[model samples]
Target: MDSDEKDSIKNESIEEEVEEVEPARKKKKVSREDDHEYTVFIKNLSFDTTNEDLKECFKKFGKINYALIVRDNVSGHSRGTGFVQFEKKESVEICLNQAGKIVLQDFTLDLMPALPKGKVKQIEKEKEAKKVEPKDSRNLYLLREGMIMAGSTASEGVSATDMAKRLRLEQLKSSMLKNLTRFISRDRLTIHNLPDSYDDAKLRKMVVAKTGSKPIECRVMRENKPTPTHPKGKSKGFGFLSFSRHEDALAVLRKLNNNPEIFSANHRPIVSFSIEDMNVLKIKERREIRSKLNNPTYQEKLKIKKLKRKENRKNKSENKPAIKGTRKAPKQVEENEDAFSGFASKPGSVPKHRGTFKLKEQSKIHEKSMKTQNKLRRRQKHELEVQQEKQEKKFDRSVKKSKISDKDSLVAKINKYKDLLKGSNDESTKKQKSKKWYVD
Candidate 1:
């Protein structure tokens, strides 16, 4: 061959060798990275779709290694979700991208990559954690939406939503102020025994006359307010008085709290703090209770519930029929004495043919016969006792044949018997073996 041809041949062989090595390396890389089974979780499938239906629909894209529509184990019905595994990774990508357009038995497919069982559970836990949200500005907006009437329409520029929120905040502020005012006048006094004829002006004059100092405010509730029918508001017999100083209020409370002829000339006054004071005390008590319950080391403080279960088996085992306190036997009964059933027989269970007179005669006859039977039984019992004595004597004589065997010699006797049996070769051994037949 020519030199140029030989050089061309050597280059061609080297190129072929390099091409083979490149393909081998590519195959190795594919095995390590892209060799996993490309599985897709498909949802919104028709209930009638079967594994065969899925395989036929997806087989056009690539060779499907497996296709299964999950079914209820008990009902054998499709679960509307399925798994499809394609042999090639590119097929899964193609299926995912075309998921929106693909239709399976009148339903569009929803497809995504199927994660491992552990990863699915972890994702669910994260979703649950995200669901628990703290209070924020959005809560007010939500409340506004709920509170607005359906018929009430909204307008632009400071809509009803904002108006509702502003109104709610104002109401909350007023309530907070009221509560604070109550706590601030914790030492203020109230009297419930004032006469219904007394008014706010009259009570104020009395306080000034007694304490020699004017109060900050005096409120008197009317039993009925002045209306078109009445020109004067009737006093309700209860009122609150606040002082500028706590010491002045305490001094006024001590003198006229239960004093007659001051607020009440006839009886003592029901004097105390406002209802808010009691509520504050209750709040403190509840806080202490919650703290005790929340303590982890105090096992008894935690709520423990005891459930009562019906003891079916124990009650059934204890079910026994009453045996004593039987009713009197009926007259004219044809029932045999041996046929005495448990407790008692029904009232009308006697045979129709038996007469009451026959029953009375039978009772007398039965008594006389019982007496004769008792005498005969006594004679027979005596004879049996004599016979038992004779049998016992015979048994004692037979037992005496073995004559005072020592307990310690039992092991020696057992060993000696075993040796005698073992020494036999055929005849005696065969006899012993023949005697070993079971009783049953």
Candidate 2:
């Protein structure tokens, strides 16, 4: 083949290889447009189902960008619903059709497009409404008039209007009136061992009959077992009864605390109750009072006052000169004669001078005794040294005598052994000579 023909063949081969590689590149970039995608819900999942399982199950129809299985917050178990995102609307419809009613473990799946934003908001609103409605119903009794009272300092015969003014009802309404009235009127009644199927209305009727009230409000404090002290399950057989009147509440407490019949089939008591005043105290005033009561400085001041009184008593006792005996008139006669005459008299004339002279004499005697003790101790030390020297000389002489005697005894034994050995050798030689003559 000519060179031009050969180059043309080589070019064609390279072109074919380029076309093969280009198709793969195009396949990678060929993704379904974002507008074509929508989230699809997959329901009836097994409790243990996971996101990866949902993706893998849907991937057969088309590309699944993401998948998730909803789980319960408390149980950490699947909620039997999940979401799957497909890259194409067509794929989403296909997944819905194919996966719908699919049996997974013990559940049958339901596939549909996820609720739109508007529908989601509506559902959330419904849930919030349901939650708020119950609380409002429980608290409706607080709106009744004449159910609360202000402090007694208000005008003695004050009407409701006057009382309201004194208590600042306008501000109270905006802040604490509702809560405080509710707390004051509320009574805690424990219903024990109630059946699982017991309803609040039935429980309320039972409480009303016991307390003689038209309506009784009750709430089952949710049991939270993980918090063993507070179980999350329905109160096994007990719940609290809150009354709208303090009179009814006190009556319930008086009658029910340990009355066994008040409890359900479980025989637990239903009469326990606590009344709490929900009034809010001024924090600053409370804090000021507490500081005064607990102040370390205040306590220290009290301690110092006590110590000062004790010290004054001790000083008074020490400063009061001791009286030798009861007062005498001779002491006055001497004072009247002359204070200067006493000073000019001889040094030993007065009893005080005589006591001083005796004290001096005692001190001299003690000093002379100490000097005699020192001389005796020195003489004892000298005598001890002389005795020690004599003992050391006697030990040296005894050791030398013992050494000479041991050497003499050893020399005598060696000479005696040598003489015996010489005699034995001479006898042996004579015996050998006699044997030699016989052989010749």
Q: How accurate locally, in lDDT, is each candidate?
A: 0.59, 0.54
lDDT by residue for model 2 (53-110), tens: 6767777778866676777889878788887766678887776777545676667788
Return the TM-score for each candidate structure: 0.24, 0.26
Best model per TM-score: 2
Best by lDDT: 1
Off by over 4 Å in 2: 1-37, 99-101, 131-440
What's the CA error at residue 361 for candidate 1, in Å? 56
What lDDT is obtained when candidate 1 is compared to the true structure?
0.59
Q: In model 2, where is the ten-residue run with the lowest total lDDT?
A: 338-347
